[model samples]
Target chain A: MQPFTYERPADVAAALAAIGKPGAKFLGGGTNLLDLMKVDAETPQHLVDVSRLPLAQISDEEGGLRIGATVTNSDLAGDPRVRERYPVLSRAVLNGASGQLRNQATTGGNLLQRTRCYYFYDPSMPCNKRVPGSGCSALKGYNRIHAVLGASDACIAVHPSDMAVALAVLDAEVEVQSASGQRRIKIADFHRLPEAAPEKDTILGNGELITAVILPPAPPGGQIYRKVRDRASYDFALVSVAAVVETEGDRIRSARIAMGGVAHKPWRAFEAERRLAGAVLSDDAFAAAGEAAVKGAVGRGHNDFKIPLAARTVARALTDAAAQKKA
Target chain B: MRNTSVTRRGLFGGGAALGATLQSGSALAQSPPPGAGAPPVDVSLKVNGAQHELRLDPRTTLLDALREHLALTGTKKGCDHGQCGACTVLIDGIRKNSCLNLALSCDDLEITTIEGLGREEALHPVQTAFVEHDGFQCGFCTPGQICSAVGMLAELKRGLPSAVTPELAAAAMEVAETEVRERMSGNICRCAAYPNIVAAILDAAGKA
Candidate 1:
C-alpha cells in the first residue's frame, strides 16, 4: 500500500476541511479501502478517518430508524429493534462480508463498497471504472460477475452490496453534509448507474460526509433478504433479492423489491412490485413477479446462468417474505 | 482521544515525534507516493492489558502492528484481505479483522488476541474444548479460530441471531449445531475440520 497521511479529525467540520485537499478520501471502516489500496486500485494520498466520529448511534427519528453512517455492521445487524422491525436490513447485512469484517465495516462504508468485479480490482487490467476511458475488461474477458441490468459502453460492473438492496426496498434516505449545508438524498438517487461516468460510484461530492441513513417506518408486512452465492459462506453474491410484502389475507396489498449483484446499482424491481399488488402471495404469483423483475436483463456468455438463477432467487425471496411469521 | 481543542497528548504525539521519525527514520515507508505522509505517526495501543506505544506508517494494518511491531504473533494472518478469519482479534471486546483495520484508526481501542485468552496453567474454556474435541488439524488457524469463538460466544450471549436461527424473537438463541456452523462460517478451515470446530464451540457455549 502507498503511504498516506492519516487524520482523525475532531468534528464533522474538521473532517470536511481536512479532506478538501487533493487526493483525500474519507476512511470509514477501512475494509474495502485498504484492500483496494493494497491492490493499487485506489491511491488516496490522505485518509480522513471518520470511523471515530460521534455518529455511531441507531435511533428512531425522522419517522423511522436513523442509522448513523459509522454504525458498525455487526452492531446494526444485532440491534434488537432492527431484527424486530426491519429484519430485511439485518438479514442483508448478515449476508455480506464475514463476521470479522462486519464487526469493523460501517453502514455508510457498506453502501459505498465497490464492485467485486475481478477486472476492476486488477490494476494491470483495463477497467473503465478504475480508470476512465481505459475500456472495460469484464465486457469481454471472464465476465461472469459483470452487470446484467445497467451497462453502458464504458463499464459493466455490478454493485456488490446486499444491505443497499434491502435499504432500496425499505425507502431509505441518506443524510450528508457539505460546507454549504446538510442535505437528504433519497436512496434511489444516491448511487448512479454506469451510464457515462463509471468512475464515480455515488452522487456524494468530494468534500461531503454522510451523516446518517434514514429509513422510513417498515411497512406492515414481512421482509426477507435472500442471497445466492457460489459458496455457502464468504463469497460475493451471484444474485440477491430483498423483498417485502403486506398481505390482506392471501392477496398482497403492497410489495417492494430490489436486486443486487446484477446491476451497476441496486436494481429496484418496480415491475415486480406492480405485478404483486392485488395478487395472491402464491408460488405462481412469485414466479411471474420474478420473471417481470428480470424482463430485460442481458447476460454475458459465462453468466447466462445468472438470468434464470436471478429469477429463481427472486421467487425464493418472495416466498420467504410471504412466509414470515405474523408480528 | 478527541482530535479537537489540541489535547496535550495530541500535540506532542503527532507534531514533535513526526519530525524526528521523518528525518532519522527506520525505513519509513515502502511505497511512498509523491504526496504521501513524510513522517511516521505515533499511536498508543493496549494489547492484553499492556499499554504500548509505537511510531509507524499511517497505512500499517493492525494485524501487521501486532505481528511485526509488537511481536504478538499469536494472531495468524491467513488471506490478509479479511476473507479468512485467521487475523481475527477482539477490538474493544468485539471480534474484528485486524488485517482490515489500520493501526492508526484503533488508537483508543482495547485489543485482545489469542495470547490474552488464557495462561498456561489455566486455559480458557474454549481452548480446553478445542483440545478435547481435536478441533484443529494443521493448527495454523487455531489462534484466530479460538479468538473468534471467544468473541462469538459474547455475541450469542447478547442474543444475536444467525442466518439459520429459526426464531428471531427467541428469549435465548439455542447454540444448535447448525447455528454454530452458520455463526462460525467466517472462520474457514482449509483442512475441513468444521465438524470438530462446531462441536468444540457448542461444548464451550454449553459449558458457559
Candidate 2:
C-alpha cells in the first residue's frame, strides 16, 4: 500500500469530481483496491471514498430492482425482494467470495474485481493485465485455473465474479455516473475481453462511478446458479453455471444461460439457449445445449478439462432449474 | 492490597504516557509522528471499543491497523491477499476481510475483533464452543474463524441465500451443519479441522 490522498465525498457529483484527475481511483468496498495496493498493482495518487455516500440502497423502481452500486453483496443477497424477484442474482452473489467478503464487497466492485490470475498478482511474474504487453506468464506456467474462452495472444484471464454471470443471464444493465453525465451499459459490454488491450477491464471511463445495476425481472419460471470449484467454499470457480428457464406445458418456452470461470465476460450460452427454446427440455436437449454452449471453447494444456466440466456444469444447472418448476 | 495498588498505578501511568506520546508527537516534529498524527494522514478508528488515532500511509490495511498499530494482534494475516479469510473481522456487525480493507475508510464504523470477544475470565459463546469442540489445532485461524462464524449466524438470521439454497424462501430454520460449512468455506484451515469447527458453530448458534 502506498501513501495517497483520501477524500470521502458525500454524493455522486462530488465523487466524480474527486476522481476526475488522471491518477485517482474510486474506493468502494476496498476489497479489490486495497489488496492490489498491497502488492502495488494499483498505485493511485488519490482515493475517492464512495462508501459513505447513500449509494447502498436497493429499491423497486420502474425498471426493476435498482441496486445501488455500493450495496454490499451480503445485503443484495439477503434482501427479500431480490431473492423473491431474482434468485439467480442472489445465488450468484452468494457463490462469490466468502461470507465475510460478501458482507463487505459491493456489487459494483465485485463485477470489477481484478482477475485472480496468480501471475497477475505477483509483479515479478509477467502478466498483460497487471502490466500490459509485458507478457502473459499464465499462458504456459500454472495455467490450470486460467481461461479456456475469450483468449487473445496478449491475455487469457477469466472474469472472476459469479454475480456477473447471473447478471449476464438476466441481461442486467449498469448505470454509470461521471463528471460529464450518466450512461447505461449492458452487462456484457460493461466488461471487455483481452482483445489486444487486456489492461482495460471495464468500459468505465477514467472518472466514471458505477451508480447502480438494473435487473430486468426474471421471466416466470426457474433460476439456478451452480459452481464447480476445487473447494466447496471460498475458491474461484473452475466452471460455473447461471441459468434461468421458463418452461410451459412440459416444454422450455425460453431460456437464458451464462457461464463463469470459463470466459472473459460472463459467457452467455446464446447458442445453447437458442437450442432449448420451444423444445421439450429432456436429458438429450440439455446435453445438446451444454455442447452448444462450449462449441468454440479452446483450452490450454492444463485447463483442457474445463471444456467438458463447463458443459456438464451447464447441463446440470439446467436440470436443476427445471426441477424447481415441480418443487 | 497496598502492594498490588502500587503496581497497578505504575502500569496505568506508563500506559497513559505511551498513549499521549502516540497521539501528540507528529505535528510538532513536522515529520510524521512516531506512529501518531502525521501524514500521509492520521486515522482515528474506533475498534473493539477503543479509539486509536495513528499516522499511517493511506494504503495501510485495517488488519495492519489492528495488529501493528494498536497491538490487538488476534487477527492473523494469512495470505495478505483477500483470497484467504485469516484477517476476517466484523465492521458494523458484518464480516469482512480486514486485509482487503483500508484502515482510514473504517474511521466511523464499529469494528469487532477477537479480543473484544473474551478475556482471561470470560469467553464469548463462539470462543467457548470452539474450545469445547477443539475446533482448532494450530490456532492460527481461530480469530478469523470465530469472527466469520458470528457473521454467518447473522446472515442466516437475516435469511440470506447460499449456493445450496434451492430458492429464496423466507422460512426461518436452523442453519444446518452443511449450511454452516458452505457459508464459512472462505476461512480455510490447513489443519482440516472442519468437522469440529462446524460442531462449534452449531453449538454457539443454539446458545446465541
Candidate 3:
C-alpha cells in the first residue's frame, strides 16, 4: 500500500473543506478504498477520515428515510425502520460483501465502490478503466464477471453493487455535499456508464462528498432483490435483479425494475417496467418483461451466459414480488 | 476525482504512542519516511483492554497493526484483500476485516481480537462450541470465523435479518440452517469444515 497521511476530520465542514484538495479522499469505512490502495490502484496523498463525522444517523423523514453516509452496511441492514419500510434496500445490502466487510462498509462507500473486474483490479493487466487508452484486457480475456449491457469500447466492467439496484427501483435520492454546497441526485443518475470514462464511477466532482441517501416512501407493492451467483455466498453476482410490483388482482398496476452485475450502472429495466403495467400477472408476462429488460444486451464471449441468466433472474424477481402476500 | 494532494484531521492520542512503538519488534520507529509515499505519523490504538500508541506509516492496516506493530499475532492475514475473512476482528464490538482497515482511521475505537475473545480456562461460548464440534482443520481461518460468528450472533440477537430471512420485519428472527450458512458465508474455510463450523456456531448459540 502507498504510504499516506490520514486525518480524522472533526466535522462535515472540516471534512468537506479538507477533502477537495488534489489527492485527498474522504475515508468512509475503508472496506473498498483500503483494498484498492493495497493493490496500488488508487493512491491518495491523504485520506480524510470522515468515519467519525457525525454522518452515521438514519432518520425518518416525511414519508421516507434519510440514511447518513457513514452508516455501516450492517447498521443499515439491521435498522428496523429500514427493514420494515424499505425491505428491498435492506435485502440488497445484506446480499452484498461478507459479515465483517458489511460491518465496516458505509453507505457512501458502498455507493462509491468500484467494479470487481478481474482485469481492473489486476495492476499488471492493461485495463482501459484503470489506465485510459492503455487497453482492455477483459475485452478478449477472462471476463466472466464483466458487463453484458451498456458496455462501450472503452470498457466493459460491471458496477458491482446490489444496494444501488434496489435504490434505483425505490427511486431514492443521494444527498451530496461539496465546496459549492449541497445537492440531491436521483439514485438512477448517481452512477454512470463506462462509455469513455470507466475510471470515473459517479458524477460527484472532486471534493464532493455523499452525506446521505433519501429513500422515497416504499411503493405499494411486493419488493424483492434476487442475486444469482456461482456460490451461495460471498460471491459477486452474475446477474441480480431488484423488482417491485403492485398488482391489481391478476394484472400488474405498476412496477419498477433494475438489475446489477449486468452494466456499468444499476441497469434500470424501464422497458420491463413499461411492459408490466396493466399486463396480466402471469409467467409468460414476466418472462416477456424479463426479455424486455435485456433487449439490447450484448454478451461478451465469456459472459454470454449472463444474457439469458439476467432475463431469468429478472422474471424470478418479478414472480417473487408478485407472489408476496400483503399483510 | 483525479488524484491530488490534500490533508485531513487526525485524532491524536497523547502519551501511549511512544511506548507502543518501542514495544513492536519491527522497530517501525525507525521508518524515516525517507523515500516515496508519506512519512510515519504518531498513532494511538486501544486493543482489547490495553492502549498502545505508536508512530506508524499511515497506510498500516489495523490487521498489520495487531499482527505486526503490537505483536498480537492471533489475527491472521489471509488474502490481505477483503475477499477472505482471515483478518476479521471486532472494532467497537463490530466485526470488521482488519486487513481492509487503516490503523489511523480506527483512532479512539476499541478493537477486540482473538486474544481478547477467550482463554483456555474459560473460552467464549463460540470458541468452546468450535472445539466441541471440531470446527476447524488447519486453523488458519479459525480466528476470523470465530470473530465473525460472534458478531453474527449479536446481529441476529438484535433482530437483524439476512437474505434468507423471509420477513424482514419479524422480531427475533430464528436461526435456521440456511440463515447460519448465509450469515457465515463471509468466512471461507478451505478445509471444508463448513458443516462442522455451522454446527459449532449453532451449538454455541444454543440454536442447534
Candidate 4:
C-alpha cells in the first residue's frame, strides 16, 4: 500500500468533517478499503478511521430498529432484538461473506461493497465500471455471475450483496451525514441503476458518510430468505430471494419481493408484489408472480441461466413462506 | 522495575547451582538478547502468556510478525488474500485472518496463535483430536482450521445462529454435521481433509 495520512477521530461529527476533505475516505472495518489499498485498486490520499466512533450501536426506535452504520454484521445478526423482530435482516447478513468478514464488515460498508466482478478487480482488464469508457470485458468474456436484470450496454456487473436485497424487501431507510448535514434515503433508491453512468454506484454525494440504517417495522407474518450459489458458503449468490408475506386463509394479504445477483441493485419485484398482494397462495399464483418478476429480464449468453434460476428462486421462496405460515 | 533485582539474584544463585549439574554439551542458559540495535521498533505484543516488546516494520502483517519477527511459526499463510483460513488467529478472542490484518492494529490486544494451544505434557483437545483423526495432509491449513474452529465454537456457545440454522431464536442446540460444515466453509483445505477436520472438531466439542 502507498504511504498515506491516517487520522483517528473521536466522534462522528469530527469524523464526518475529516472525511469531507479532498481524496479522504472513512475507514470502517477496513475489509474492502484495506484490500483495495493492498492491490492499489483504491488509493485514497487520507484515511479517516471511523472505527472508534460509537456508531456501532443497534437501538429500538419508535418506528423501527436504528442500526448504526458501523455495526458489524456478526453483531447485527446476533442481536436479540434483530433476530426476534427482523429475522429477514438477520438471515440476509448471516448468508454473506465469512465468519471473519462478518466480524469486520460494517452494515454501511456491506451495502456500499463493490461488485465482485473479476474484471473490475484486475486493473489490467478493460472494465467500464472501473475505468470510464474503457469498455466492458465481461460483455464477451466469462459472465456466469454477471447481471441479467437492469444491465446497461456499457456494464453487466451484478451487485454482490445479500443483505441489501433483504433491506430492499423490508423497505429500510439509510441515513447519511455530510458537510451540509444529514439526509435519509429509502433503501430502494440507495443503489443506482447502471444506465448511462455505470461508474456511479450509490446515491450518496461525494464526501458523504453513511451514518445509520433504519429498518422500518416489518409487515406482519412469514419471511423467507433463499440464496442459491455454487458453493454452500463464503461465495456470492448466483440468485437469491427475500420474500415476506401476510395471508388470511389461502388469500395473500400483502407481499414484498426482492432479488440479488441478477441486477446492478437489489432488484425489487414490484410487479410480483402487485400480483401477489391480493391473490390467493397457490401453484398458479406463484408461477404467475415469478413470471411477472422477470418480465423485463434480458439475459446474456453466459448469464442466461440466471433468468430461470431467479424465477425459480422467487417461486420456491414464496412456497416456503406459505408453508411456514401453514405451520 | 524493582522486581528485576530479586529476579537477578535468584537467577545468579540458580545458575551457579545448575552449572555443574547440567551436561557439558548443552548450550548457555541464556540466548543472547537480540542484538540491542536501536530497540527493535518498540512493538509491544502480548501473545499467549508471553509479552514481547520488539522493533519491526510498520507495514508488517500480524501473520508475518508472528512467523518471522517473533519466530512463532505456528500460524501459516495460505492464499494471503484473506480468502483461505490457513492464517487464522484470535485477537482478543475473536477470530481474524492474520494475513489481511496489520500488526499495528493489534497494539494493545491479546493475540493467540496455534503455539498457545498446548504443551508437550498437555494438549488442547482440539490439537489432540486432530492428530487422532488424521485431520491434515500438507498441514498448511490445519492451524487456521483449528483456530477458526475454536472461534466458531465460541460463537455457537453464545447462541449465535448460522444461515442454515432453522430457528434464529433457539439456544444450546445440537451442532449438526451440515451446520458445522457450513460454518467452517471459510477455511479451505487443498488436501480435502474436511471430513477428518469436522470429526476432530466434533470430538473436541463433545469432550468440552
In TM-score terms, candidate 4 sits at 0.89
A83-103 per-residue lDDT for model 1 (tens digits) = 888989888888888777888
At residue A134, candidate 3 shows an lDDT of: 91
lDDT of 1 at B55: 88
Against the reference, the lDDT scores of all candidates come to: 0.86, 0.83, 0.86, 0.82
Question: TM-score of each candidate?
Answer: 0.92, 0.90, 0.92, 0.89
Instruction: Specify the CAPRI tier of model 2.
Output: acceptable
Model 2: pairs clashing at backbone N, Cα or C within 3 Å: none
Comparing 2 with 3 on TM-score, the higher-scoring candidate is: 3
- lDDT string for model 3 (B57-147, tens) is 7777888788766778789988999877888898888888899888887878999999999988989999999998999999999999999
lDDT comparing candidate 3 with the true structure? 0.86
B108-149: candidate 1 lDDT, tens digit per residue:
889999999899888999999999999999998889899999
Model 4, runs deviating above 4 Å: B1-44, B49-59
The candidates' DockQ values read 0.37, 0.40, 0.41, 0.17
Interface RMSD of 4: 10.4
lDDT preference between candidates 2 and 4, better one: 2
True contacts kept of each: 0.65, 0.76, 0.82, 0.31
lDDT of 2 at B100: 83
